[model samples]
Target: MQPNSVSPASEKQHIVIVGGGMTGGLLAVLLAEQGLTVTVLDGAPAPVMPTGPAQLRVSTLTEASHWLLQNSGVWEYLDMSRVQPYDAMQVWDQDGTGEVLFRAREVGAQSLGWLLENGHLAAALYRRAADYPNLHWRCGVAVEGARREEGRWQVRAGDEQWQADLLVGADGARSRVRDWAGISGGARDSGHHALVATIATALPHNACARQVFMESGPLALLPLYSDPQQGEQRQCSIVWSGWPERIARLREAAPADFAAELQAATGEALGEVTLLSERAVFPIQERHASSYVAAGLALVGDAAHVIHPLAGQGVNLGLLDAAVLAEEVERATQSGRSCADSAALARYQRRRRGENLLMQNAMRGFQQLFGQRALPVRWLRNTGMRWVNQAGPLKRLFASQAMGRGADLPVRARPRA
Candidate 1:
């Protein structure tokens, strides 16, 4: 239902969320499912079921994230035919003999992760959210202002105004809600730009995701569904990162030249590459909010932190943020406290910020390590990778982390009984 028809204000705890993209949309559903009133303000129109060929933008959903979607009733709305489950992952260095392979069987799991277009996931979330009567969707409505008054949040969109017990900013990297709330944060460029595109490969991807680390940056070839007519598992999505000038040149190069370069980059691992979609490039930036919560207001997803996409964990981290915040809100309610209790928001921040920071720093370290040109540094990294591959416990540890299996996962993301 559109937000034009205002529901009679009730005593139910209400939440106002700005930005109804993937993360905010999920948050709205999670809160509304708990009997809380949620209103989502999104500048973009309501999402519809994505169709036709895959989009250039995509996201990798880890096992934990998958569980969150399933438990929240969003997974069923997705088109399973478009979901690509990768059973294995391979990482290697282009400059050295450092190679490591992780298979689902090693961890007793059926698949490592699922890859799907970003639009598909967002649309599925909006579809599931529609099932909740308590959820109000304000499509094509931009939040113009936000502030605190009388222990509640006052949000304004054009001439419309809303008050809520809690206010959340899930509006992505350049969150206006965050700015209005006076949350402090900074973004640092990673000195690299990622060029993303969909491609058709001569050889089947074999349900495997692969990445090759070069001095410039890392290039990942993630598996996707095969072409229906051809019925060959050759469809893949590529994220190639490098210096701004280098990425610019690659983005403008002829399709054949680009495909040739892609083939060379992967050492023909997937055989000759054929560009099937237009390429898009985006600068890499690392951002973190100095504090995730202030009073009844909180930030989640990219509004709170944004890390490198090297491991495809950006979306996973955002999903975890939504889950943890929901859990904390539920915990506060059960304990006879307000859903926007400061302690609850603090707990959510405490649980998420450290982990997100760790991953961000880790990615920075990996980039710097691989970017090194010294011979000793190169040998050390290559030998370390080989040793880790040979070490069963270490390999399993890495695999488990990549699959989002950790002790501190929010209750919603945990495996079902």
Candidate 2:
């Protein structure tokens, strides 16, 4: 198919976003809500409810993200029955005696955050976008190539061509749109792999999220909804980060043997862990683009940066990126200016880039600090955790930051009364 004819530059901004997953769909819906024409292209189909068991791919979304979803009309569409809220977090050092605890009530919040399948959010974002007239979703196709023509962006996908005054890359870590914009960055390898799976614990999860710093890396047992297949609610999602050699052993181990190792790793916190799903492993790495914007293009979410999963801040940060970009775009459109104008894009980068870098660095720092099995490093982290836990003000400040409320938030992401 021939490329679609390009729109005149003088016309209102027509935006085309690549990668229609969580971030792309979100940015599309938001721009459409601002009355801008948005076309989303992805090689994948829209998300729908799974037919069998709960999925292993999940994210921990903060209150700020929840607020943005609510305003975008996505949160209300989520299947709450599949959602689980954690009011508490228990983090401890495995090789040491240091441990710290956090609770939402200390921060005057009902629950800290939630754990939901990635597909659940994708489905919600897609369903919410369906109600908007300005959102033109073109799924099961990809942006073959993108180029700037006549001060606008034009992309080729198979036989079809879609042109827009502005373009965005939400295509994730290996973003083709970002490459098209000539953005490059060096990726840092954490030298670890994350193994994810669903398991039924010998004891109830008790609605608490737990993590333990082992010699290998950090292990998180995020509370998840019960399994519909089992007719019981005792399952939890676990993410264990470790070196490739160790991860391979677990991945190849027998199910029963893997369960025993997992239980031993957690110090038997939730009792024996019985694996309920096949363990999946992914290499962990940190990536950030040198710049988030080009002349007629911008990047958001994993396209711009990918952080360590230590704090589970990866998705929340991406959602914030979408919110800030939408806010900046709305500001420009209201002033009768191009939404992809240099000034507006710069504002978005300025607001989001610094925060993302901070989180990325923090995760790296913890990884390095905890990667050591030395007596001194272990002692230091444990002591620090003890102090942070014992000091009321310090603990509150950390909790607020973890909740994504310590800094100024985009109005679209602020919670409603």
Candidate 3:
């Protein structure tokens, strides 16, 4: 296709992305690919260096997310060896009494998901973005605020002012763009903080993910490829959820002491564990923005919504937003409409907002069911899970949604089926 024609006097509808994280960077890459000029304004560089005192977090990429990255031309440049695939997941009670298992083999997929470091994925996307001439990377620049002017968006960053046909707020949970757009959000605190850490295990995890549910909350153990320097070292990242008092005690424990406690907490699911690094804690909360778009502004990723980490869907949801928005822009442009046209923006808002609401409701239902302590409720929930695990058709249906395939997505997001 030839480059999009523009009049000498006509503004090119410059798009200003407020965050250079995964969502913002991906959006910039996608929009630039469509022949639009974009400038990503972020306080940090694309390949963000992890701070020593900061915690290391991992993200699980679903099959649908993989498709999005592949389409955006980022996945091909990623280090496949650094990403570990988990074909199966096992969930059981903390006491090792009841259990349920999910396997991609049963659903005829290669794997359920891939576990990878956030930095690795971001680096791959950032490197690919630099190749696009239409994408202007503006790092180490912070945005103070955004306001709507006469038929345009005005953004204040540092000591300068920038104008755009539309502004995207990918800044995160505390999004300044969302605030400027006058969007409200609701939050729920589960009263539990997850203690996340990496540890070396004696036994091989063999590409399996495990989640043990206790009365307090769920404890997740995700296996990753061994580190290069540590030979025969099997590493698994742990997210242990418990009450504040218990978490406080665990945080204060010595490295060896905490490792033992974690091993017992997981019932030696991945074998003996040794703490290899410092512990990090993240409080549990669910947030949802009232609306995704307003006049010449929109929100993506965590800035739009957040859910419980028990299902590992946060990053996946963000990527889905990028995909849907790109499709909307592509469709609008092909039909002789501008990128920020009101009709095009409304189409995006209607579809993405509905999909996010469904996922949020499903997550809330799971949280309520799992947090129940009644004996009858526990037995009923376990039995239901067991039945679901045995039913082939039902299992496939649920797994398809988890993989981000099937009919759950909007019409624009579905590939063929």
Task: Choose the strongest candidate by TM-score.
Answer: 1
Error of 3 at 298 (Å): 0.8
Estimate, for each residue in 130-224, the C-alpha lDDT of model 1 and write its tens digit.
78888888778888888888998878777778888999999999988789888886789999999999999888999999999999999999998
- TM-score: model 3 vs. ground truth: 0.92
- Tens-digit lDDT track for model 2 on 1-417? 111223432444489889988888889888988888887788897678654677999999898888888888889989888998889989898888788899999988988898999999988887777787667777687668989999988788877787778899999999998898899955788899999999988788878899998888999999998766644557899899999999989999999999989888888998887888989999998899999999989999999999989899999999899989999988988998998889999999999999999999999988888889888888899899998889999998887788888376899887667
TM-score of each: 0.97, 0.96, 0.92
Structure candidate 1, residue pairs in collision:
none
| Ten-residue region with minimum lDDT total, candidate 2 | 1-10
Cα lDDT computed for each candidate against the true fold: 0.90, 0.86, 0.78
- List candidate 3 stretches off by more than 4 Å: 1-13, 48-55, 229-233, 408-417
Which stretch of 10 consecutive residues in model 1 shows the poorest summed lDDT?
1-10
Q: lDDT of model 3 at residue 404?
A: 86
Using lDDT as the measure, the top candidate is: 1
Cα shift from native, residue 181, model 3 (Å) = 1.1
RMSD of each: 1.7, 3.2, 3.9
